[model samples]
Target: MSIVTGSLFALALAASPATPAPPKPATTTLAPGVTLLRGEFVPGRQPDGNTIVVDAPQGLIVFDTGRHAEHAQAVLDLAKARGKPIAAIVNSHWHLDHVGGNVKLRAAFPEAKVYATGAIDAALGGFLASYRRQLAQAIDMAASDPKKQDGYRAELALIDAGERLQPTERIAASGPRDIAGRRVELQVVAPAVTGGDLTLFDTVTRTLFAGDLVTLPAPLFDTACPARWSAALAALDASDFKRLVPGHGAPMPHEQLSQYRRAFDGLLACAASKRAAAECTAGWIADAGALIPDAEQAFARTLVDYYVGNVLRGDASRLEANCAAPNDLH
Candidate 1:
């Protein structure tokens, strides 16, 4: 399926109470000094494609964990390669992908400390509440449709298998600190993508581990306030990072991040214009043919799908809204 179709399907699944449980976490190396670790509970893909790893001199640090325990084990393997124990595990946010490996990481590296923006802890708390509500409602939806009901049963099974991961710690974004032997600075910029979203900067490498704050094909509004997201991107634009890493997609220079920001702003403007003209469609996919061009069709459609089915519909708003810095969400 197309990225747009896939995203749309994910939305439908997320709301149906029968969405397949995510896969056990896994690991994959991204680039030198970077690893994309998977989470434990996410299904095949989407929403649960978390990337966790350590950086240079940053010693043992984690970016994010996939949705399952196995993914955490994958991280342990990577850490083992370093020939040293993990010093810290930082959750990008409260999302299952980013935080799923928390418990396992703690188990593997008993001495490692977990850190995250206070906002992430808050975000997780809200997600759990909302997720429970969504499941309850999804149960009813599934009951009405046999196919959906079967899926719901599968989800129930996954949950019963202890697939979901929740945060049990709290951390503060206490600015810059000495990670391993490296001196780095942490900044909680703006919550464009998610409420408590932020990034870490390595002054030495001039690299910024931007969470979901800077995404490719434009920032995913799957869980965002467009206007607020716009402001957040602008804030990022005003920042000083050169190299950047995103929660999804590969890493690139700041210019690439800018392109995403522009695309996001442009789309929001289009949405706002449509809203002002009183010609807005009831669905995100309705206007893709006209507003999104083919050259960048995949991304445009992805944005449309995420905005319409996820953001506009208020699917994960409260989770994003209540996230804070120095909070534990894994």
Candidate 2:
């Protein structure tokens, strides 16, 4: 398969498994009124995106629902514990891990209005189509083992029944929005993570809910526009928020965010020189230093290669390709 599809396939294989019972997400209170629900970082299972819950005076506001049913349940449990009804739900981007629990959250809080950028339609369409194809492949591969087959089938049923929820309140521009008596600044940074990325900055808590715009450990460049992503990161660097909540991983401080931005800038410069993918990958791995540990060096190299070959090159055909043979670039 092409580099983009292959990269996604690899990530899917690493994250998506039909575990009989998924573990609970770890929740951390970032501030007095803000809480972060972090997804488990296991190798195989329904991986979850981080969910942020904001307790507003009128009610509760949630950002980015986790991927699995259990993950969503964890967010619900937090809301129940806080004794506040969900007033609004905000989707940072359209990725499945970020938006997968939309249906469940909406079901629980029917009156909760959803707010997101208008870019979700295209993202949702692409994901559902790709996921269906991948699920079929997984089902075929599991045919030899009845237990595995049943697991795949169960996952397929959830996919078929899952509903992708669109934003009831579309965020067309960046500015201050008053939701449930809470003031939030919605910053639109598109073609960075996805075409519909919306970064929320809480005026009260000074917390920046940066979707996939600022990932820890390693950034996912699968659907990124290198230049635009870099520009988005630069903008985030200029923001006044004190605490940063990424789409995945734990909440970090400004210093850590700056560190990630520097690495990203260096990688972009390396790719811009039109160097060999391997050469660029090595340079990035070297520049990243301890940011990428020795154990994850191989994976980091593969990601760098994908960024250079697909993202910087502007060659997205790989994302739509259906090659029978794996690229094995990793």
Models 1 onward score TM values of: 0.68, 0.83
Residues 1-330 of candidate 1: C-alpha lDDT, one tens digit per residue: 001112423544755443454554445555566566533222223354356465656467776655444556667777787786777766666555566566677766666665565554444345444454555666686666776766544434433333233323343444777666666776654354555655677676666777777544344554455666677667667778766777755566777666667666655665555353222222232333332334555544545555554455433434334222322322
Most accurate candidate by lDDT: 2
Instruction: Candidate 1: list runs displaced more than 4 Å.
Output: 1-32, 36-46, 49-52, 55-58, 136-174, 275-303, 313-330
Candidate 1 accuracy as TM-score: 0.68
Q: How much is 286 displaced in model 1, in angstroms?
A: 17
Query: Which pairs of residues have clashing backbones in candidate 2?
Result: none
Could you report the Cα RMSD, in angstroms, for every candidate shown? 7.1, 6.0
| Quality of model 1 by C-alpha lDDT | 0.54
State candidate 2's TM-score.
0.83
